[model samples]
Target: MSAPQHPTETASTAEATSGAVLSPVPDDVDTAPTELPDADPDSADAVVEPVDATGGADGAGGTDALLVTEGDVAGDYLERLLDILDVDGDIDLDVEGDRASVAIVGAELQDLVGSDGSVLEALQELTRLAVAQSTGVRSRLMLDISGFRAKRRADLTSLAGEAARRVAASGQPERLAAMNPFERKVVHDVVAGITGVHSESDGEEPNRRVVVLPDR
Candidate 1:
């Protein structure tokens, strides 16, 4: 994957409490550039595990309750952020499957999305931290601004489908560019639905990519 694009403006870390002002980053959050590890041509196949957006197992009543709390906490936290930035946006919160899903919809919020969503990723981690600070548990809340992630998901789904078809026809493996956990999961899911092919992850964080393999 490419290096994280840092925002021009910075903010000091603050408490995640109500009315707390959070910077684009928190002091504890790591913004270091993630270097792509070298690829091992002979590496074993490692299936990319499905990511649980809720950060918990499915079908537990307590998990559902916690997800609701996560949404509430994250919504409040994001609202405060928009207020601070003087940006007008609507905060939509929901419990999707086992995870808390929050979306910010409005005009002129592309800056929050940043280059290739680096800024949005930073904000998401910070929001999760905020939720954890309040709930005393780690959060797996997913955040989106201006529908950037939605569009990206559609594009990735199409790309994975095309790659799967090519691999199945050629009976050869195709290595995709490194992707974040979210992007990898999208590709994995799409590939899983297709016949005659499968997908696995290789390399390390920020460099880990999906490999489409034709089933022998």
Candidate 2:
């Protein structure tokens, strides 16, 4: 078992939340620097602080229009910002469960994804905030750039399977590399499906990772 550490401590002392590890506290050793310029949150992303947009609100249902509204807000914000950035991409919006989802579609938009999709993750947060500001409520909007998230999901699922196999064969724990919250969740889900192995989170944000344990 790894030693537990405070949330503010280094990655070595990291602890897990939700029984699994990983994601952006916006810092950690696993994080890769991106090529995109540091964004100005106060600029186009937050420029529209209007409320009264429809769709999602507090306690929205799965099929609620609120999520769509949230997507619209985020999509509009992203579209305008992309135009300013001179990035040629089409923003697609969808109401995915209780959250709004947005994807920047276009081959030329790879630079927006950055190294290890760090730029995309940061952009996602900004989009969610933009939706919240426009709707006068919090938003749980997911963002994807150039199908990077889709590809990452497939890879993480495979990683979880490999980790499970290793744990089952060794009858020991296997700690995975640091990942983001979304990535960790996918890995945990995969771990839950297999027998004789269980998963737990370790470390802090940005450096937190999943640890697979064999059935003792």
Candidate 3:
């Protein structure tokens, strides 16, 4: 039997059917440093400390620049994907904290988001891999489609506050339904802001849930 086709696949391009993989890296883009200078035994300064390739001596500036590059790479990759799929959408990129954030906003993007944002999650992983392939460093880039994550974040924040209140009032632990990593992180952040209560994740992936506990 033939392999299943992605929901976003079209007759125009059979090669781009695999939404999990990005285009191969170009031969001209060197992924590694060419060489290092030889150390001289006669000089005391010959022994040099290893430098961080991703983020240099100025940690903040280097890290910010890397994140910007990640956003740009991700944007370009996503743009090509949209073109292949013949899907119309606008890509917006930004650097949020230590990670890069990208969002695709336009009509008829529900298919890309999939049910419960499953497809969106897969696309995000693919985009991160593409950025890593170009920069030779793993990326923690976040992707959102049609404001799904933004709205979800708001909803989760509210739910977390409610759960925290309930736990605080009854002095009992409350466990929420299973949530993905992104959802769990939002809940954890909200719960952290409220006093007298804390949150902990339990169970395995796809079944993991957050438990709100009152501080003793």
Candidate 4:
């Protein structure tokens, strides 16, 4: 038998009390970058005081501000990460619904994704922690590299669609291979969208998976 997998080490580390701030950015289909004038650190530092807009006693004002600030902090953090790894990329930020979203687009970032995106998941949790520490707000930020996940989601969605069709035709529950939470979520979503099909997650972390069932 294959050895069992463990729960995400970073998931347990998140300080649950901190709130996650997400500000959705309007979609811009173009992923290309436009060059800007070089940054002047001295002038830049003098212009703004970095404060966690997500922190403090502003009450209602803090909510929206916190969302935007989380994006800024996350962008800076991702930039530093790229620098340290000697990778080149453009960072894009947006807040959609209730989550802050960040995407890194570059040609040379495959290493960051790792096999099956295990490394990306770890990096995302760590980045969220960094944002939380800076803004004093827990962030459930979603990070994407080279659109690897976007493509993966599309593929999974198609696979789920096929599985759901087969299950409806065969009238049997589909037991799929084990998948990470993100992948399972994609499958569940695709299957759930169709008529007379239902999906649920079964098992536990790491080994946890989704099972698609025919409607009764």
Task: List, in order, the clash count of every candidate structure.
Answer: 1, 9, 0, 7
lDDT digits (tens) for residues 1-216 of candidate 4: 111221111111011112211111123422121111111122211122333532644454555467667778878888888888888888877765445677777788878887767678878878888987887666766777777667666666666788778777876666565666556656666776787767665556655555666677
- Estimate the lDDT of model 4: 0.60
Clash pairs (backbone) in predicted model 3: none
**Model 2, position 55: C-alpha lDDT score:** 36
lDDT of each: 0.65, 0.61, 0.66, 0.60
| Native RMSD of candidate 3 (Å) | 17.2
Q: Estimate each model's TM-score.
A: 0.73, 0.70, 0.75, 0.69
Q: List, residue by residue over 1-216, the lDDT tens digit for candidate 2.
A: 111111110011022222222322232333222211211122222232322334333344523566667777877888888888987876777655445667777778877887777788778778877877776666766787777777777667766787788777877576777766666666777887788877766667667566676666
Q: Report RMSD (Å) for each prediction in the order shown.
A: 14.2, 13.5, 17.2, 17.4
Judged by TM-score, which candidate is best? 3
Q: Which lDDT tens digits does candidate 1 get at residues 1-216?
A: 111222111111111112211112223433232222222323211221232544455347767778778888888888889899999887877776546788887888988988778899899889988988887666767787877777767677777788889888987677676666666666777888899887776668767667777777
Cα lDDT, model 1, residue 153: 74
What TM-score does prediction 1 earn? 0.73
By lDDT, the better pick of 1 and 2 is: 1
